[model samples]
Target: MNDINLEKLRVNRGAHAAPKKRRSSNTRTWIIAGATLAIIVYALLPKPTAIQATQVVSAWPSQQYQVLNATGYVVAQRKAAVAPKGTGRVEWIGVSEGDVVKEGVVLARLESRDVAASYQAASANRQVAEAAVTSAENEMQDADRNLDRTTLLFNKRLLSVLNLQDAKSRKARVAASLKSSQASLAAARANEQLAKTNLDSTQMVAPFDGTVLSRSANVGDIVTPLASAADAKGAVLLIADLNSLEVDADVSESSLAQIKMGQPCEIVLDAYPDRRYRAEVRIIAPTVNRASATVTAKVRFLDRDPDVLPDMSARVAFLSQAVNADQQKPVMAVSPTAIVEGEGGSHVFQIGADGRAHAVAVQVGAVLGGVRAVSGNLKVGDALVLAPGSKMSDGDRIKLADAP
Candidate 1:
């Protein structure tokens, strides 16, 4: 009986130890299953895509019709460096930079005291010559009468032949003196004209209607026809006809075929990027630059702007058609790649503040340069994704591949 009880107790102890081992094995299995589930859940979550972005910009409607684009500068076709014809010291200036002048307007005056004095002296000489000529005419009249009387006396035989011969000789001498005095009067008149011309040269006048760009000479500065001397200025005023302002743009020789003399163009000055000017091709240079392989195209403005200036950096867009008055204003534009077409129509994935892309519905309009004009809940400088993939959806997180 004692051996039987000990055997039963040993069997009970083994059964209890087996239950503890099974419990520990079950605990480890549960822990491994929980870890597997966590891993699968992590794998199913959404991942961010690396992408590039562009900003919405204010663009012109004319850009849609752009065939070619080129950079250049505003040039005045009627530009001139106005200088005096005769060299002299500058005495007075009547205009400054930015002054508008008309044709033949006197801009400055040189030292003319010496020239004026010469003119005055020549005038006095001319008057004296006139007086002398009058006296000579009276003397000639008297000589003619005396010769007639001498002839009559010789014919009547009332006077000796020697007396008549001496009277004739005196008349001939007086006639010769009259001729000499007449010649002197002509010479005096010529001298007066030359002196008057010299006096007129002392004043500088405008060549055409233009705006003064600069005043190169000041009071007491020497001005010369050619600025070869270090102390002499070549031009008193740098003037340009603002009406003749044009853009000299360089176009590639290969693209020159598209350019036409009457073709319309849009001009945007670097100084005023927001402003657009209406222009047209005025001239196409017949020659091409061998070094740059480019040809110059001259563009003229259709309407003049007071702010447009010479040599201001500019960009030219050669267009297929002219922009109307209403289309001249700016419009919202975006890259074509950023637009996504769907059953719901066109939309763009603009990156929201939360780093996720939000679809903004857009009504796509004209194609501008490399971008498309769109009207929607968009503004200038809003970030949009470029080339969104098929898997991309609304509210999907995105990682920027580049800084916006």
Candidate 2:
């Protein structure tokens, strides 16, 4: 009674519980499978490609272009402070500021009354000296004739020795007086010329072909050699020879060997925007500045500009290759801002197909003016990134900005 009754009771109670546990296990197994499948699908999704970059391009072949990028001042090769040669009062100024002038052309005038008076006085003195010399010569001639007669009489024993001696002394005195008067005349003549020259200084003239930069005096304005508060003095006018216009550019001391006299160059004047003038390296200064270690260079213009004036800002471009099969400055041209310095040294970022920047180490040469001369692995037509940090990488792809 005990085994049969207990077993039947337990089986009837647990039969429902066994099926519920099996169903619960099946639900857990399905949830675990679904979660794993979701993770696998997420990991297998595709990644986004690198973004493309924009770069600026230059028309020049990189190797053929040699640019000497430097800032400079445009200066007239022959600039001068038109000063008075002598002290004088200004009567008139023939030329004004910005007026063009030729050599020896009168530019101003000074009051020459005193100088003229002195000239006349010297001329009068010279005439007096000449008349005195003439009178002495006549007296000497008379005395000489009298002395000759006395000497002949003495020789014939008809004249006394004392009388002949007196006549000879008179002749000698007159001869000496004539010589003295002649010297006085010559001195007077010299004085007259000096006075004339001083009078001539009243007129100012152009020293060379130049443009008047300033007129310190006007008509009726008095100017003197010795500066005075009352007189407009010192530089009466600032004149500059336009024919010898040049750019005084500062160059890095390290780039001296690459520069030479007569090297072809291009110049851009700040006064004349966007116009490039043909230029040549007239001289590389032998001296260097101790502070900046920069050498000042004198560059010459092949074509003179009448409008070019002193102290105008300028830029010189040293060409790397012949601009037109003509010898020119060594300008290795690249995008104006293509040069960027990074860990790999001064380099150009040549964006590659993999959308990364390939930093090409470049040896930069002298920047003659606006053109930057660069050498090393960069080729003429290779695409380079102008903006370094903008979407640039070692192997990044680059797209050109629109034709503008």
Candidate 3:
């Protein structure tokens, strides 16, 4: 009875163990199948496409009409190095760099004590000469009266011929003395005028309405008209007429034919790249530069800004027509390659912050240089995919080729 019971228990345990093993094997098979399925799905999914990108920028409408382009510098057509006419040590500087001055405004003064003293002496001598002329006139008048009386007495036989001749001789001598005194007075007046001129020269004055660019001489520096001396300063101040500011652009000789007087232009300064100035061609240099094969075109600004300074690096765009007030404003622009044309009109793929491309419908306007004007949900600094492929769609992932 014990043997039969033990054998039955063993059989039951083996059957239970076999079913458990089968269950475990089934779970392992399901896990492997799920992992393989996941791998296949991942392989079928579209991957991110690598693309080049460019930034949308503000562009001028005048760029559409640009016929030629050149590079140059801002220059003041009326510029001068102000120096004293008379050589002397600098005494006082009334102005420094960036001081705006009107015409004939005194910019600096030289040591003028000697010139002032000379002028005073000349004035005193003029006074003395006038007094001498008065004395000579009085003596001449007296001599004339005496001669008249002597002539009357001689005619009445009350005076001898010798006395009459002597009276006439005295009148002649006084007249000669008066003439000498008048000549001396004229000389003294001329000397006084010259001395006054010299005194005036001691003050360096502005030749025109301008802003002072630099102060080349100090209070103690010696200034001279000709900068021949090693220690002497030729110019006390460097000044420029801001109103006369213009751009001197160098255009290739082959492109000179397209430039004309009064041709409208857009000036972009390197110092202020965001700003644009309206300008027109003022002069086309008659001669060509032999070395550079270029001609200088002088362009005058129509809209003046105080910040426009001399020698600022600039780029000029010579336009076929003038830009009006509305056209001067900047418009959103993108590279031509960035635009994609389809049956639904023009659109651009703007990369979103989520690293995905979003299609933005745009209304294309005039072409601005190498870019095209577009108005849409775009801004000046939005990144746009350049030369998007036909397969590119909205919500596609993008990898920037320019990224490190």
Candidate 4:
């Protein structure tokens, strides 16, 4: 029972136990307390619904109140299928498709060898007629001199009356010959003009200033005035005045009452869908088509484009009123995705001031420019939930992902 014996007894009695087990117990208690506190905090905090949002914006004034829409084509009011005045083989073509030409510009030429030769001959004959006219005038002058001399001789009794009469007859015959020569000269000049005209007819010229749409004849193709032959080209070139382009649309007879001449219109071409061309009603047909029960109307473009060509498909939006730069007004418009279907009938989940969403009943009007025109208790800058989730409810908190 000495000191050594006491130490051995203390070791066996657990007086030197490891400190790790004690530390582990305290850690377990702390962990449990921390977990309970985190749970309580999460339960008391608000749950924000993550969502996509957009602001209601204004629509274009022209689109804000569209009366009607009709599909049509971009057409040139001043279009022509140009051909030669006379039938002949095409000798040369000066213009290709898409060439801009001025009025009376030579576009093509037909075979004119015969016509040119005839013209040359007529010109030579005209020169000969001029020479004859000059010679005839000289002879007439001589005849006047002879007649004067004969009259003087007859008065002086130096010549017999018969001889004086014979001189007078000679002068008269020369005068008649001069008169006949002048008539021949006049006829020759007329023939020259006619031949020149025929030669000019062999060349085709533009009727007006326009862009060439197509070239129908090759250098060797035969072009005819009447296009009677199967192998002959009916037109040398198809051209149109680009400045005189318009949209020809067919409107249902029932909708004619809603339109009139000089009405403002917005034209959208298929080639330039993003851009809008300002237009106005130019013509309305007096009668309706019995087959389609539609009336044809022409809409003239106020603006022009190089890309716009004849036969290009277009859409015409007949507006309620004219839309000018100063006349455009802001409108309450929302994206199509913002609309929600519910038992309340066409409602929107508008973001509230408190970061919550509240149901707002909207009376939707026209869908314009991919945005819907709506009348509701909404402002221009108000944000609305786009494609709301099923779990979303009235007064539910939401966190906007981004500004639209």
Q: Best candidate per TM-score, number?
A: 3
Supply the TM-score for candidate 4: 0.71
| Residue 400 accuracy (lDDT) in model 4 | 74
lDDT of 1 at 145: 89
Give the distance in Å from residue 103's predicted Cα in candidate 1 to where it truly belongs: 2.4
Candidate number with greatest lDDT:
3
Which parts of model 2 have CA positions greater than 4 angstroms off? 1-63, 226-231, 325-404
Q: Give lDDT for model 4.
A: 0.87
Better of 1 and 3 by lDDT: 3
Q: Which of the two candidates, 1 or 4, achieves a greater TM-score against the reference?
A: 1
The order of the candidates by TM-score, greatest first, is: 3, 1, 4, 2
Where is model 1 poorest over a 10-residue stretch in terms of lDDT? 1-10
lDDT of 3 at 389: 83
Question: Model 3, 102-171: lDDT tens per residue?
Answer: 9998889999999999999999999999999999999999999999999999999999999999999999
Report the lDDT of model 4 for residue 68: 86
* Tens-digit per-residue lDDT, 205-318, candidate 4: 999999999988899998887889989878889999999999989999989999999999988888876677789999998989999999999999997778788889999999
Cα TM-score per model: 0.79, 0.64, 0.87, 0.71
Q: In model 4, where is the ten-residue run with the lowest total lDDT?
A: 7-16
Ranked by TM-score, the better of candidates 2 and 3 is 3
Clashes of 1: 0
Q: Model 1 scores what on Cα lDDT?
A: 0.91
- Estimate, for each residue in 1-404, the C-alpha lDDT of model 2 and write its tens digit: 44566655565757689899999999999999999999998878543223323343222332245656677998877888887787666777778777889899888877888888988988898889889988988998899899989999999999888998899899888888989988998898898888888777777788888888887766666566667656466668999877888999998888877778888777778877545677789988888998998999898888766777778999887765434422332335565467776665777777666644687888765443344667777665666676566445465544454412
lDDT of candidate 2 at residue 109, scale 0 to 100 = 77
Clash list (residue pairs), candidate 3: none
Each model's C-alpha lDDT? 0.91, 0.73, 0.93, 0.87
